[model samples]
Target: MAIRGALRELSVQLSLLNRQVGARLELKDVDLDCLDLINAHGPLTPSALARRTGLHPATMTGILDRLERGGWISRDRDPSDRRAVRISTRRDRNAELLGLFAGMNTSLEHICAGYEDADLELVADFLGRAAEAGRIAAESLTAE
Candidate 1:
């Protein structure tokens, strides 16, 4: 119960932080999340993005358009499938994104600095599983 409570607090705080970051960059919360998705697992297709995000296809189109207009992402022809499009974060904006997150990154580093390597590994594994659990919960809700 203690860990779950702590995680709930962390989730809310992270959401707030992401909101602030999104506003600073002139992005909507959902758009910013989509951008993060692209940055993490992209060079992907619009359909794949929609699937991963659980957003409707039409909504994904609008989000992609917004990101492209903001110069946060680029839509290009897929090399392997010329008829399809691939989405990717713009290389030029990497520094800008990283700069926005620098403070948080630094703070995270400090927080982790005291932890032993084994402890960090355990924490990382826990976080990964937690994320997967969240994803599954979301998928179930979406399916409903």
Candidate 2:
């Protein structure tokens, strides 16, 4: 019960953080999410991005168009498949965007440092599982 409550609180905090980041960047939360995906495992194809984001193909196209126009990301032709295009953040601007969240990252690291190595490993494993659960939930939402 405590873990469920904590998870709910964490989800709210994360949503708020994303919204704040979106407002500060003058971008929508969904766009920020797409940027995050690209930042983590970028150069992904448009279809792959749509699948991961659970966005409709048409909607993803629009978001990609907006990001490209904002100079936050670019669309490139896939070398292996001329008909396919890849989505990726602008390497030059990625640092600038990431800087916005550096403080949060530092704080997380500091908190993690308070734990013993074994405890930290357990935390990591737990968080990984929790994140996987989130993906599963997102999949269910998309399926509907």
Choose the strongest candidate by TM-score: 1
**Per-candidate TM-score against the hidden true structure:** 0.97, 0.93
Candidate 2: segments with Cα more than 4 A from true spot: none
**lDDT tens digits, residues 1-144, model 1?**
899999999999989999999999999999999999999999989999998889999999999999999999999999888999999999899898889889999999999999999999999999999999999998888788
Backbone clash pairs for candidate 2 read none
Clashes of each: 0, 0
lDDT of 2 at 143: 92
Error of 1 at 95 (Å): 1.2
- For candidate 2, the 10 contiguous residues with the lowest summed lDDT are 93-102
57-144: candidate 2 lDDT, tens digit per residue:
9999899888899899988889998998988888898677778888889999999889999999998899999999999999999999
lDDT of 2: 0.90
Per-model C-alpha lDDT, please? Answer: 0.93, 0.90
Which candidate gets the maximum lDDT versus the true structure?
A: 1
